[model samples]
Target: MPDPNSFLYNNMIKGFVDIGSYEDALTFYFQMLNNVYNRCNPNNFTFPFVLKACSKLTAFEEGKVVHGQVLKLGFSSDVYVETSLVDMYGSCREVVYSKLLFDRMCKRDVVAWNAILASYTQCGVMECAKGLFEEMPVRNVSSWTTMIGGYIQIGDSKEALECFYKMQKHGMKPDKLTIMTVLSAVADLGSLEIGKRVHEYMDTNKIEIDGYVGTALIDMYSKCGNIQKARKVFDGIRSKNISCYNAMISCFGIHGLGDEALRVFREVERTRIGVDDVTMIAVLTACSHSGLVDMGCEIFNLMRKDYGIEPKMEHYGCMVDLLGREGRLDEAMGLIESIEPDIVLLGTLAFACRIHGNVELGEELARRMSELDPTNSGLLVLKSNLYAVEGRWKEAAGVRRLMMDKGIRKKPGTSWIEINNVVHEFVAGDASHSHSKKIYSKLLELSERMKLCIPTTQRCQV
Candidate 1:
């Protein structure tokens, strides 16, 4: 006990960290710091692990105490200690303090740069994140990935992809993390072609396709309108985890493949795999889309009873939408009344009322919608349309006038045509183009042709 070795203390901390038991490491660290025998080697090894544990536990006060000890022990200027401090503060949501420590570092390594960049990203300060990215003297795989990930988190898929391209141009081979970020961009873009190329790269480079990466691929392909390929990818994953199943089921449900999605859900349930809210919402939405009333009812009942999954607002919205689609206006209203009426739920009610020509309910829902989102042009349009359908021409015109006064213009009606791999968009009454006359003539002819193909019931209704 007279000369407690620093190596033994370091090894103990390392073992605790390796086991992902940060609290244990912190406990041992403080014990060593207080021990008289360990006083001589105070600067040796404990601070880094203590900082990590503090970060992991979000022990901000304890972390500050350790920071004092780190400075007193003369390890304050150490690169590793500085980086840990930056990460700890960042994780504790003290980005400003993390940045202060980062700015004080005499020499910043890749880990330090990555830590600060991640802090900015997580804090949702994208401009500052970009500034830090630009200031990095030497960027590594983690730096590039963190930059791209920040963009992704902010829903800037285009900028994220641009960053990915820049990373590739710098001659740095992207690792699995980079691929995961790019896949996210591709998923948002709904591009099966780019997704396939990424899959090819992963396969050719022997990149291990774990659950996270594999699920991402399935999600990308399915969202891009290739559910079959998504299924194939799902099957190819050797270590199929619950997340993989959730991704596939979500994609299938979203794509209107209700039967296929239900099959997958049943299979997952058979395996005793747990279904979280994401899985439940996805499945319920699929059932709603397909008008599977009985199936939806059974699933909703089972979720609350057997699975014990509490129905969230989204689930309630899906149920309302399902009932509304089937012309069960009373049932849909009952469902909405069962829960607090949020914007989505009210919106669904408005849509159903419009479909059933219930002008009263539509007006009520419109009033609530205006309160929830006063300036939403779509809600105003729905309300105006309901008035128009009820032959309340004066009311409809008044609604439009109110919209104008509020400076909320109805969204322009536009259609897209892909001709020779180039997408061309046309707005209503658009006539500035040289081919305007020809475009109008073709659209008129197509409208006539589409009318001929309409079903008897729809033609009668029209």
Candidate 2:
């Protein structure tokens, strides 16, 4: 035992990583390095396990030290070791480092290619990921799934669906992870038709609707405005996790079915499935959107009293929003003032003040916002609008002049619509669409027709 060799060190590291004890794994790797009496030189196997720990912990500095050892010990070109180094660097967000190691590899295996592909994808560089994906001699499910996930990460749901369908065209069957990633895209797009197709695919292939997938289905259906299907999927799941409950509660929340959300929360309490921070946030958000202020305040107290969970900034933000939405400006102000000032929480109250025509409080909030972030174009605009609403044209013009002097242009607002399964995205005053002329022509036609209806169409004016 005095001379624990490379084999012992590798096992120790692997065992710890398996149990999710990344810190312990690194500790053993260091111990093996410094073993005085019979110090063992790490072989090819030693580096991968050690590098894995570094990757999981995102310990970039520690991983760099391990890379030095790999180079010094002549295991730099070992396929497994090189791949692990690539993975470690990628996980640590050093895309350049991972690609450099990948480029230097003597023999490029699929695993090595996937590791680099993942690096680009994980960094949200989908263009590079796509180029690399096409160049690969072959790809497995992980490669395809990683690409799909990259598209989803950048909020390109249509592109994600295209990639998924292309994967099918390549005769590659999707694994569970791929399905889950695509479900998110469908949810975001609110593409009910495609979501139904995915559900059918799962049924045809007999894919189990396990905890994660069921939760995703619940979300997908809810977002797509099919709350009934979402509830059905929730009820059909044989066993439910806290996430499943949270999804169902959130689904009800989005639909403004506050009572239904409360029923699910009560069920979580009765079943004692254990409430975490996320559960509290979900329920509180439900209450906020549904205007259940009294219930929200009561449960907010339960965070520390019953759950032993200290309310964090997000919790306080939710309470502020809830109170603000109810036009309780004074109570909202007192609550936010009692905590450390958060610009977002303050903005929430400021917005409420503007909504309720509380110009005096809006002025105070404008001063606070400017103090917090002088360069915030949105706040500058908010302040100008608040002044204009109160007929303070001089002050409004002054605020606008300050914005121009600072060269701070307001960010353009954006919106999107889906037509024939294609999502068309547009920003304010955009005319870049391929069908822009046709779209505008049709809009003008509709506007002319709308005027013919006269005062009858007043409520539906373009």
Candidate 3:
């Protein structure tokens, strides 16, 4: 090799880091340090790429050595070098060290601020992130997007939406990343009205619906229960990628439109778009729900033999559900035994046993499940229901007493409904709504109407 301390070697290291060959970058960096002739030392330009490699590899020991080298070289005050060190520590999940480094900086810039802000966000300390965000001297689009993305990452979709609106109020136009992030939050919330407004804004601004944005719109519309709009968006995409097709297929699967999903799959095949594992899963799910057993079997076989896609556990689970729903208990049980045991798969089979009135198998499965999840009250409840259905009230009472003795209780189910761009949450049997009385009165009126209609139907039968 040429002199390891040469500028050529430095550029080569940078090239490797740029192309994501982090290990190669680190190798060159170490070779330069170990060189006996050591005439050329790493300058300000060299430390950032080496630090980036260490960060990418999470090599804390090497990173600490590099930090010492930077201090000895008297390049510690270089803004780029300091910013890179902060980013390196953050990426390695050593946020405290990153913060200490930041506090030691004699001057701060936007890049330095973003690095620490990202560190806090990445570590799931959003409260600290928000505090830093408020203290920032200057806010940019990146700053806003980071905060919004942090909320989304923590499953606080509501807060993400609020942040987006706040960004707009500050006269910041959202770029593609911001739009995609907010759309995802909108989908999770199922706020169709808000989603519609976002769509309208894009249209009014004449923003091009590229692949990423197009996929997000399709996903948002489909998840929000506006399938027609999803299809429209799908048609509008000039270049539909595999994800776009997958979204459309999944949309059909969720709506139980097996034929439509199959048709779309066929179209994908004709275009030679190369369907992936996700596509097969969607196909099998659709067939399962629509009771297309023979078609599902054909597709499953084709996926492995023709497409060379090995079936995952989820694929096996779908097949088990398909067979169980069709009352093919033996086949489902054999399939379950062939694979590793999973709680969800066992639960599905247990429920199927209850539905098909196979109390013996149900009891055995429930017993095995109890051993696996002894603290689960839902399993106990299922066992009790199974006994009660078979006229074994004594056993049912015993299961209930066991639950009481163990202090196990079922969690209340909660649901949400969106209206007028707002979401309302309710738990089972909850009467906390302001209009609870009016809601109950309307429900009673509907119940009385249904009761009167039932007697008229009996008179007609006579």
Query: lDDT for each of the candidates?
Result: 0.84, 0.90, 0.87
Tens-digit per-residue lDDT, 1-462, candidate 1 = 556666777778878977889888877777677677545355536677778888888889989988988888789888988999999898788999999999899998889999999889877799999988898888899999988888888888768888988988999889988998899988876666767888998888899888888888888898678888989989888888889988988888888889988999998899887888888888888888777888998898888788888998988888888888888888888888887888889998789899889999889888988898989998989988999889898989998999999899877897545354333557888897778999889989998898899997897556
RMSD of each: 5.3, 4.0, 4.9
Candidate 1 ranges beyond 4 A from true positions: 1-98, 123-127, 409-445, 448-462
Estimated TM-score for each candidate: 0.78, 0.86, 0.80
Best-fitting candidate, measured by lDDT?
2
Question: Which window of ten consecutive residues has the lowest lDDT sum in model 2?
Answer: 453-462
lDDT per residue as tens, model 3, 1-462: 565555877898999999999999989887777775856678898899999999899888889999999999999999999999998898888999999999999999998999889888877799999999999998888889889988988989999999999999999998888888899999988888899999999998877888789889988998889999998998999988888888888888888888988999898999898989999888888888888888988898778788889988888878888887898888888887887867777778888888887888888878888888888888998899889878898999999999999899888897789887779877777799998889789989987887777877675433
**Candidate 1 — what's its lDDT?**
0.84
Best by TM-score: 2
Total backbone collisions, model 2: 0
Pairs that collide in candidate 3 are none
Ranking by TM-score: 2, 3, 1
Q: Where in model 2 is the C-alpha error above 4 Å?
A: 1-16, 19-46, 72-74, 401-407, 419-426, 431-462
lDDT of 2 by residue, 313-406 (tens): 8988888889989999999899888889778888888898888889899889888988989898889888988887787989999999998898
Q: What's the CA error at residue 234 for candidate 2, in Å?
A: 1.1
